[model samples]
Target chain A: MGRTSDARERILTAARTLMLSRGYSALGVAEICAAAGVPKGSFYYFFASKEELALAVVEEHWAGQRAEWTRALAGDVPPLRRLRRLYESTEAELRAGRESCGTVTGCLLGNLALELSTRTESVRERLREIFDEQVALVAETVAEARARGEVTVADTGAAARALVAQLEGRVLFAKLYDDPGRLDALWADSLALLGAEESQGAV
Target chain B: MGRTSDARERILTAARTLMLSRGYSALGVAEICAAAGVPKGSFYYFFASKEELALAVVEEHWAGQRAEWTRALAGDVPPLRRLRRLYESTEAELRAGRESCGTVTGCLLGNLALELSTRTESVRERLREIFDEQVALVAETVAEARARGEVTVADTGAAARALVAQLEGRVLFAKLYDDPGRLDALWADSLALLGAEESQGAV
Candidate 1:
């Protein structure tokens, strides 16, 4: 039982890393198994198909990310500051990814959304839900900021969507250029989108 | 000579459609040829390899898009209005694509950028150039708006990058949800990012 569970964990870890770099369609089961150092039969035992494995990978990555997001967004700092922390964490993560792998892998969910959303219905639905959740999390912060008169935007949901969109967009560029600095504008841009007071010290 | 050129065009058209929906790595030369109704031999004749064909597709699509962008960004209207026109055109294009294909295919360049940027260096360089041009084009409009005192953004280039990132981010949502209406917030969000006067008729 221990060996079986270990194989599953190994497969998930390998798939997450491979999918981050090469995306979904370009990878094969055999390649993932080879990277995981597991036999091909173990893959079938863990994942009924490559698509199933993708769902597992998405869930696993999101679980970790959601925890981080929860931590970043739920602190003693001001609402906007917490939101800024989210972007900071994202940038720091990208910088670390580049330093370790020599390339920016970008947001795995965003990458999979762009690559497989249209082609894979299951993945598409999951991505839509994940993005919706991301927007909602940001919206909660925006709402808190609004209650405190920290931001001028009337629609917190719309503002949150814009913020997430900006993050994804900048991350795309960061990956394309292999430079995490592309995300430097995210905080200021987010402040602008939220209509935060100029006193917020946006640059 | 006419027939030869026609075959090349057919391959490009098919590749663009396929790449938009299924992405780059998911496709094969034979499938593109089958869709183009050209023989497999004709594909190799027109392009050296799949990567070469992708470059051709990128150039061809950009050629058409660049023309549209130039037309949208140039005119007697205010720079902000020109920018709004560009977004309107994009929304219209997405709506039309959905009507015809029953799915939102998203931006071909963005789809490819996320899918191929890490695995394919040549394509990565080209996508980087294309996005840079996109930022530059938008920056020119922002600069014009700034000169007219229509906006207050101090860094036109950075604002342009933010605007484009917002665009790509929203478009990703549009594609993921299979709903073009996801882009309706772009104009308002953009004006906010630029710190345009509230008198500018934003949402």
Candidate 2:
């Protein structure tokens, strides 16, 4: 049982890494198994199909990210400051990824969302749920900021969506240019999007 | 000569359609040729490789989009108004795509950028140039707006890049949700990014 569980974890890890750089449709189960250092039979024992494996990867990646997001946004600091920390963390992750992989791998969810949304129904539904959760997480922060008179935006949901969209867009550029520095504008951009005063010192 | 040129056009069209729905890595030359109603041998006659074909598609798509962007950005309108027109046109394009295809295909450049950026260096370079051109086009208008005191953004280039990034981000959502209405926030988001007044008549 221990060995079986270990193989499953390895498959998920390999799929996430492969999907980060190459995307979904381009990946193959055999290649994923090879990258995971597991035999082909173990792949089927773990995932019924490639799409199922993709779902497992997505879930695992989001589980880690959600933890980070919760920690970043739940601090006692100002709401806007917490948001800044989120962006800072994102940039730092991209930088770390570039150093380790020699390329910006981008947000796994965004990359897969664009690549598989139209082709795969199950993945599309799963991504929608994940992104909705993300927007809600950010919306909670925006609502806190609004309550404290830190932001002028009226619709917290819309504001949060815009911030997430901006993050994804900037991350897209970061990956495209292989330069995580593209995200430097994210904090300022978020402040502007939320109608927060620039004097907040979050930057 | 006319017959040969017609075949090339068909291949490009087929590839564009397929790439929009399925993306690049999943596509094959034989399938593209089959969709084009041309012989597989003819594919090699016009393009050296799939990468070259992708380059041609990018160039052709950019030529059309550049023309549309120029028309939308130029003329007797205010700079902010012109920017609104650009967003409106983008939404309209996405809507039209969804109407015809029953799914939002998204900005071809953005879709390709996220999927191919890390894996394909040539596509990455071309996408960078294209996005830079897009940012430059928006920056020119931003500089104009700054001169007119319509926007408060200090760095026109950064502001423009933020607007473009916001756009690609929104478009990604539109595609993921298969809802062109996802772009309704773009004009508002752009105004925020540009630090333009909410009272701007553009919205």
Candidate 3:
């Protein structure tokens, strides 16, 4: 039982790492098995297939993201401040040079959703829910600021969507060019755009 | 000589279509050759390797984007109107309910740049420069809009980058969720965010 469980954890760990390096569809089962240092037979023991394994990785990754931003937003920082800090931390990660997580691989669920949506409706729905959850969290942050008279949104929901876009897009850029500064640049604008002085002041 | 030259065209044509369907890394030389109806010998005869084919595809794709956007932006339509119309067209395309293009596939070159930068300086530089060209053109358009009082941007360059992010991220979302509504929402916000509403006093 112990070894079997260890094999499962190892497989997930390997999948996570390899997904970051090679993307979801690009990485092969053989490569993952080799990377995990597990036997091929051990694979079916944990997950049904590569798609199932990928879904597990994506779920685990987003679960980590939810915890992270939730903790950050829940901290002493105000809503707008939390948003800025979020962008700042992402920028810092990019600038810190070279250690990016899988979330920065443009969101595994997102990448897969793009690639496999037609073929895999189950995965698509799962990814959409994750994204919607994250977007909801962002919207709540926006609304919190509105309630506090920190920012005014022309449309709170639209604003939330843009924030989500800016966040994901910035990461995509950072990962695209391998330069975190691109993220820093975009995030600064995103903050200013969303936090327009009048827009915020009036609200 | 003409027949031999046609083989090169066939390879590029096949690659373009396949890249759209299967993406860069997901595709192989065998598929391209088969799709082009060219022999394996002909494929190797025209291109040395898959990477070489990717280079060609990247160049072709970039040029096409540059040309398409340039024409769209520089047509008889005014800058602001041109942007609105193009986005409307994009919204229409999204409404058609198909896979989104590579603008969100992290910019195939951007994807290649990040994945291949350490591996190849040439690919990295090409991607950076190409991305810059796209940004610069959009910046020029924003500058024109600023001059015309069609838009109000404190910083044209930042606004341009945001526009690029908006476009790219919208595509990502569209693909990610397999729902065109994401694109529609993006276009709506895009017009609201970037389109300068004419002053009430103005005609």
Candidate 4:
């Protein structure tokens, strides 16, 4: 069962890579199978259709982000410091032009929110919930900041959405310019807006 | 001659609308012609190929954006206010559920940047110029804010890129979440960063 499940996981990962490079519409199931080294016949045993496979792929991506953020941000570091560290690591890779998932992932769910949301409420609803959860997590940090008086966040909900918006924007810039400097600038401006004492920390 | 040329312009508009709604890859020439009510022959007469048409559509979109920004973001109002007004107006329209162009138009240019930059230098170079132009324009505005002492910009170039990055992200947000509130939240954070007094325009 473990070996079989590994095949399923590998197939989903291949789909993710292809979608990141070629986009959702251009990615094909056969391509995933080839990349994953899984037989075409085996894919249906694990997933129903290309869309279902794509959904699984999206779920996997979202889970990875949440887990990563949870670990980095919820660790012993201060809330503000954690946010800075996360963005700082992103800045280093972008500046170095290393292989990274800067911003353009566009949210697998957010991507679906655009392409699939109106047509399929179930998927759309899933996306909405994911966004809500991520925002809530960020909001918890903001709430902490508010308590500490590190910054004046009159609206925690609005602040969380704003951070998401900023991060989302950075992704587009990173992808659009193919030069990560675009995102580095966003990192600085975000830190500045949050009234952070350090600008050099992000880069 | 003007009437015939006007029809050509009409064709370009239709292509842009389709690109924004459906994205560049998914939109077909026939579909654009149908939307424009322009004959297929007319489209080919005005443009060499679908890729060529994509370039033109993106170019026209940028032109309109420059004009819109100049008109909407200019005035006696403070720099921060003017820009936020521009953003807020866009937000109001999106919240009302209008298929506005700036959000997605899938940025035929950005779509090209993401998909074809490595494979097609001709496409990449042209799009690069557009992105640079966008960055420069925002830098100029940051200089304006700096002149007024309304904001302190240590790196005008970075600030410019971040500003545009924010807009690009807001566009994706509009597509992903289909919500304008997200954009407004971004606006609020940006204005705050620009040193806008919270008392005057607090969201």
Evaluate all candidate structures by whole-model CA lDDT and list the values in order.
Answer: 0.92, 0.92, 0.67, 0.66
Identify the superior model by lDDT, candidate 3 or candidate 4.
3
lDDT of 1: 0.92
True contacts preserved, each candidate?
0.89, 0.79, 0.33, 0.40
Candidate 3 chain A minimal-lDDT segment of 10 residues = A194-203
Candidate 2, B74-169: lDDT as tens digits:
957888888889988999999898888789999999999999998888989999998999999999999998998889999999998999999999
lDDT by residue (tens digit), candidate 4, B56-121:
876787787668667656766766666666677656645544544444232344445655443445
* lDDT-superior candidate, 1 or 2: 2
TM-score of each: 0.98, 0.98, 0.85, 0.82
| Residue B39 shift from truth in candidate 2, angstroms | 0.7
Q: CA lDDT of A11 in candidate 4? A: 93
Score residue B140 of candidate 4 by CA lDDT. 71
- How well is each residue in B26-93 modelled by candidate 1, as lDDT tens digits? 99999999999999999999899999999999999999999999999996688888999999999999
Which regions of candidate 2 fall more than 4 Å away from where they truly are? A201-203
Task: For each of the candidates, give the backbone clash count.
Answer: 0, 0, 0, 3
Candidate 1 regions exceeding 4 Å error are A201-203, B201-203
When 1 and 3 are scored with DockQ, the better candidate is 1
Per-residue alpha-carbon lDDT of candidate 4 for residues A1-203, written as tens digits (9 for 90 to 100): 98899999889888877776556656677888999999998899999987787678778888887886787677476677777666665565445433554333433444455455434445656777888887788788877866777757678877776676677667555655566555555555655566655633332
By descending TM-score, how would the candidates be arranged?
A: 2, 1, 3, 4
Sorted by DockQ (best first), the order is 1, 2, 4, 3
Q: CAPRI verdict on model 4?
A: acceptable
> Which candidate leads the pack in DockQ?
1
Query: Best-fitting candidate, measured by TM-score?
Result: 2
